[model samples]
Target chain A: MKKILNDPAAVVAQSLLGLAAAHPDLLRVTTDPAVVSRADGPRPGKVAVVSGGGSGHEPLHGGFVGPGMLDAACPGAVFTSPTPDQIQAAVSRVDGGAGVLLLVKNYTGDVLNFETAAELLAADGVDVRTVLIDDDVAVRDSLYTAGRRGVGATVLVEKVVGAAAEAGADLATCERVARAAVAGARSMGIALTAPTVPHVGEPSFTLADDEMEVGIGIHGEPGRRRERLTDADGVVAALLEPVLADLPFAAGDEVLLFTNSMGGTPLLELYLAHGIAEQSLVDKGITVTRRLVGPYVTSLEMQGMSLTLLRLDDELTRLWDAPVRTAALRWGA
Target chain B: MKKILNDPAAVVAQSLLGLAAAHPDLLRVTTDPAVVSRADGPRPGKVAVVSGGGSGHEPLHGGFVGPGMLDAACPGAVFTSPTPDQIQAAVSRVDGGAGVLLLVKNYTGDVLNFETAAELLAADGVDVRTVLIDDDVAVRDSLYTAGRRGVGATVLVEKVVGAAAEAGADLATCERVARAAVAGARSMGIALTAPTVPHVGEPSFTLADDEMEVGIGIHGEPGRRRERLTDADGVVAALLEPVLADLPFAAGDEVLLFTNSMGGTPLLELYLAHGIAEQSLVDKGITVTRRLVGPYVTSLEMQGMSLTLLRLDDELTRLWDAPVRTAALRWGA
Candidate 1:
């Protein structure tokens, strides 16, 4: 692909510098390629929270480095998981005296990388806890590969858990909140068009004009199955039924409803899907206490969207309601 | 268009209900049909700031409502401008005893609708002002139409103004800050694929695999011109030159840079663009103080991106640094 970059290899490094330069008050990038943290370091007695993922999901890991969210985030190359060395640096940089927690989305590469970093931190006695988010419902029951590919619910997990951490929750408390968020959330996505990975100038997968792929992964992985084109409502139902059924959420359940664009679908259609999904939940007598509709967790400009629901309780609600000041999820300050 | 909505007319209403239910504490759907605001009225003595546009830009007006960004947002149909009545409703609902300011993007329909509403609010003896956001560098010297259509800078205007409003700036101060933000900002966008409006199932425009449309509007409106597809670096240069030349920013000037996805571009591409754009700025010796890369203000699902630059001063920097808590933009507590 014809790109404007100076050197493909230098993309991540230069971007981090620009990010730090942009929000000096909110973020600080290490001179050596180690970590991206809040402009200020680990607040006293506040258990620091850290997370890392592949680079493409900007604002997810980096934009999220601020007061209310992750204390620090490590970014890797496009859709490629961060190296353990980078994760270890972020862990060391954000480790306040109170300890630290690592929130890892359940991808094979991320799981392995974060796990290795945890071992490294443990060796350093920097007290650490790991919370894995495996929330995507797209991947069907699997005896061979793991079940769901963690997708949209990662944002809610971070926000709720970040609030807990920011409130000076102990590492255990923060980990509990993060785990609860992961357990309560479910997400599924569908794609109308396959995305083109920059390194590869062609589409990752192809779909006919009259066809759409359901249950696709964030990296253009094949979905559960393909079907003839369907309207937004049908797509919503298709996406939501599996999530709702998998979670076994019943009537009167209070949940957070999220409709995420896979980088490509417009918010117009997401709202349309959101409308149908709302009615679907209302008809089922479920109550959604909050709704977040946007491209929170995305696949690079792939024309698709995912619906995520997080069942909420008074505690979860309080955490969700608490003030946050991150670059991505911010509210109630 | 094939849609999931039970009725096209009910889309906004139902979505509002879902939004309110999901964020009862953060947002309320007023009795006036399409207006959504903070559950509570505006803070007394603070400038009541309101923004509204077509509904396709999710998280723009509504998602931005909170303590620091927008006091209220009036949502309209998919791509149609919100009626004056809707804007008026938003003004009355968010107006504290002090007054209200309307941040209208420079789209002809949006400008007309908001201006009429401002006049209506004036008739009620409600203090009001409007800042026209003509930030797009694409449209030039049009005698018949308003200059360039407002693209991404509208969000920066709201953020800076919202900070001023939150800091207890009176209406005039808020207005001054907002207008300054609009004046100092310039943006340009390019489209890789045409977005399909929800009601209009077909693509808004067509492009060959080897072509990309430059200087495009967020709503899939045509750009000043189209060009052969280029690499990410080339695309960034194509977008930045016009914005830089139009503003003629100096070498020592600090800037707040924004790389906004038109809806469909992925984060990886966005970061790559950010990496390249920052280098270009460095080569030019420009001081970039803040950087934001995300799907902040998006078109429905146009496969494109926009670059925005805001030359900053001390007062503007302070306003940008002020604490904000909203569904989208949040800062210090």
Candidate 2:
């Protein structure tokens, strides 16, 4: 696959160096490659939240390491979850006097690694809480496959729950908020093209120019459905309908709508999908109090989009409106 | 080229509808195909800041809209700047009791469109100021060839200067902060593979499996140099040497380093680059005060990376630390 680095093996290391140089105030890297955190460390008494995953998704764990997001993000190789050593180091680095929370996405490697790290840290007497995000609506039931992959809803989980963590909310409250976001959220994606994995140097799945795949995961995994290409409105409806049906959102329910691009779809198209999504929500009598349309949670260079809706309560809405400071999701004056 | 868009022409309109539906509390669609603030109207007597560009770059002008970022963002067609009419409407919608400021990237189209909007707004007795971000060090010619094309540094400008504007800093102060960031910053990028523009339907440029393009732009524009791929440490040096040399950063100079993926790069690689860059900065005696590593600004699905450095002073540091409330950027309690 085409890429910009001198060597694939060195890509992660060089990129981390570049990141540290770029936002020295907000992030710092440990010498052992196990920890990345705000240079200023955690705020006093606030529970430190640490998250990690394989590295293909930018801004997921790293760009999210800041004031209102994860205290530190440990990135592993592309599509490979970080080693237990890395997670344990991150736990040690960000474990302030209050405690530390581990936000692990539902991917098996991520969960297993974080779980192991939690045990090791527990043995070391570090207070830790682990929150597992399993919000992808696409379910894979087979002997060989892990359950449903954590797709685009991970971004919303980070944003809402990250704010709660930053508000001096304890580990329990943050975990509650995160769980609420996970339970209230559902995401469905459709891909028109298969992405080339860098290591493989070829397309993961070949699709005709006119064909599209639905329910894609972050690793270019095959979607749950494949069909002939559809118009923007139809595509948006196909994505949103499944999510709404599964979540069963009620009328007048305030929601946070996130139309996420899977790497390659332009903002114009994402916004177009956003429009259709808005109309769909209005037609369904759902009140969308907030919206985020962009490539927040993405698959690597996949040309597609996902629609994520978080059913909001008064608390979720207020938490969503709270201020945050991170390398990626920052807002509030 | 591999995009999932239905019709390239309808992408913008569709996306605007989605944004309106998604964030009714944050954005409202103007009749003229622009997204305006949902906050009644622009506050009376506040200096309105407006920004925009092509639709491919997400979380830019659109995500940066809130109390601190742009009052409104005028999104154009994918990879194309908005027309004067759209800018005029955006300016009008966001113009409050105070004046308006146009924060523009240094591309020719963007500069021209925003300049025209500024002139038109002035004709209507709206006070307007324009700050052009020309931080990309890739361009060597200042007296010719449009100088430098604005890339990832635009995010920093918007956040820091947006915070100033949100805090009631006058147009002059905001302008000064914006310019300070522009002057103190330098960026350079390299593309591994070019993105497929929606209309083009193919890669903008081609490279051998082993070759790399250095000094590239956010779009698929060719870079100043191309060479055989090297190791990550060497690549980081190649990306940063030019920036440091061009800016003449010396020992003890505190800087902000940004490792920006030109769309398709994995965050794992970005963090690797971050580590290498941090070592380089330390080795060269440069004290980095901040770092941001991710795809903040992107070029469709281009596979590449860019490095940005901002020389920080006390004022810039303070402004950088200021709280901001936008869709993408938020900080403080």
Candidate 3:
């Protein structure tokens, strides 16, 4: 595969080094047990937020670590869950006296490892809670996940819960806010091209020039089905139809619309997708109160985009509007 | 080509509509003339900054139109310069009585059109000055450019000059600061793949699986030469070496190191490149005091990255740290 990397095996370590170099004022990276923490972390009386998964979906766990977002992030290798030791190390480093909240995406390896970390941390008398995000409507079950695979909504969970934690919420309140975000949100994505894992050096799946995957997962896994390529509007309809129906959002309900690129899609296309997605939601009587359009959570050079809708309540809206300063997803800071 | 678009002919207009919809709080788009202006613009007594070019390099001219940046932006068709009338219309709309500063990239069409617009606005009794950015150290001359092709440094120009404008610099002062930025900055890029123009329906160029182009332009134009694909470090070395030597940056000098994605390169790779580029600079005894990484300027999904180094004085450094809130670049705001 054509990738800008030093060694396939060193992708995670090297990229983290780069990330640390790029944002030294914002992040601090620790080796041995790899974890990225806020430069001035361990806020004396605030609940610490930690999140992680595979490394490919950048700007997710690591990029989201900062003042009003994740306090620490433990990134594993591409598409592989971080080990329990790594997660525990991250949690320990960022856990202020208040408590610690772990945002775990609903993947088997991630769930197992984060749970193990939580148990290990609890043994040390640290208050720890885990919030699972499974907002992808594309899958009912998968080879690597049960229920649904977490996708774009992980960003929403992190943002809202991070805000709550920053606002002096206790562990229970932060956990509740995170759960609310997951409950109110749904996401779906499609792939025009598959991404290659660096170590594998080949695409996990293949698609013809005239075909696209309708409900592709983030890790280049097979989606719900393959279909002939269509226009932006048609693709938006297919993805949003399932998401809107699943959420059963009613007229006049306010929501935050997030259009995310899967990696290789340009902002030009993502903005076009945002326009189409916004119109589709408006036609359904939903009011898009806030809109975020970019490559937030992405695969490795995968040409695709995902639509996420988070039905907003007053409290959720307030939390969503809070100041956040991270490598990615910064506003009002 | 697989792209998220409607009719290729409508790409620019539709995408601008999406951009307007997504950032109505920050931007406003006017059709016919097709100008994107700040939602609260024409700040009286402050020099207005206006920029424009071809459409494909997003978040450059358009996304950079907001508070503390461009007061207006005019976008042409993909990879095609906007007409003179469009530029004039934007200039007229944002001339807040303190005169207007036009930041033009050094492309043949862009320079011609922006110059024509400057004359038109001048004849209309509005004071106007133009600053040209030609920092690309790629080709000394090319098919579409005379001196050097303006590449990634246009973003730096807009940002530094925009900050100066927001700080109440007069038209002449803004022009001077912009010219200084252009003089002190140099950039070079390499492409792993070419981008396809939407209407063209084919890549502007092609490369073998083991080949890559070095010192490439943003429009997929040929670079310095084609060479065997290499690791990220080798590529970074090839790019930074030329840029550093061209600027002849000296030891003890502080610089803003910018590593930009041509388009399709992921944040993972960009951060890796940033690390490599920063080390190369430090090795030369130059101190990198600031960094701006990511796809600030891009070709439409081209797989490449560029390195830009802006020699910073105290004024440029202070202006760089100034609060500016644009759609793409935001910090300390």
Q: What DockQ do you compute for every candidate structure?
A: 0.39, 0.43, 0.80
Candidate 2 lDDT tens digits, B1-333: 445456766666655666666556666675366555635457777778788888777656686777666788888877788888899888888787577778888888888888887888888898888988887787754322287888878988887887787788888887888888888888888877777767667777888878888888776677778898776767788889898998788899998787777766655566667777878888999987776666678787777788898999998888787765555555662
Worst 10 residues of 3 chain A by lDDT: A25-34
Worst 10 residues of 1 chain A by lDDT: A140-149
Question: Per-residue lDDT tens digits of candidate 2, residues A255-314?
Answer: 888888877666656777787788788899998778777666766677888888899888
lDDT of 1 by residue, A122-143 (tens): 9988888999888877775332
Put down candidate 1 lDDT per residue, B115-184, tens digits, no spaces: 8888888998999998888888988634323787887998888889988888888888988898889889
Candidate 2 overall lDDT versus native = 0.76
Candidate 3 per-residue lDDT, tens place, A257-296, comes to 9999998999988898899888887888889999888888
Candidate 2: which stretches are off by over 4 Å?
A: A10-51, A62-76, A81-104, A107-132, A142-146, A155-181, A194-203, A318-324, A331-333, B31-41, B96-100, B107-131, B140-148, B159-164, B167-181
> Between 2 and 3, whose DockQ is larger?
3
Candidate 1 regions exceeding 4 Å error are A1-14, A28-35, A38-48, A95-100, A113-129, A140-144, A160-177, B1-18, B30-33, B42-47, B95-100, B115-128, B141-144, B165-171
Q: Provide the lDDT at B258 for model 1.
A: 90
Best by TM-score: 3
| After superposition, candidate 3 runs with Cα above 4 Å error | none
True contacts kept of each: 0.43, 0.65, 0.69
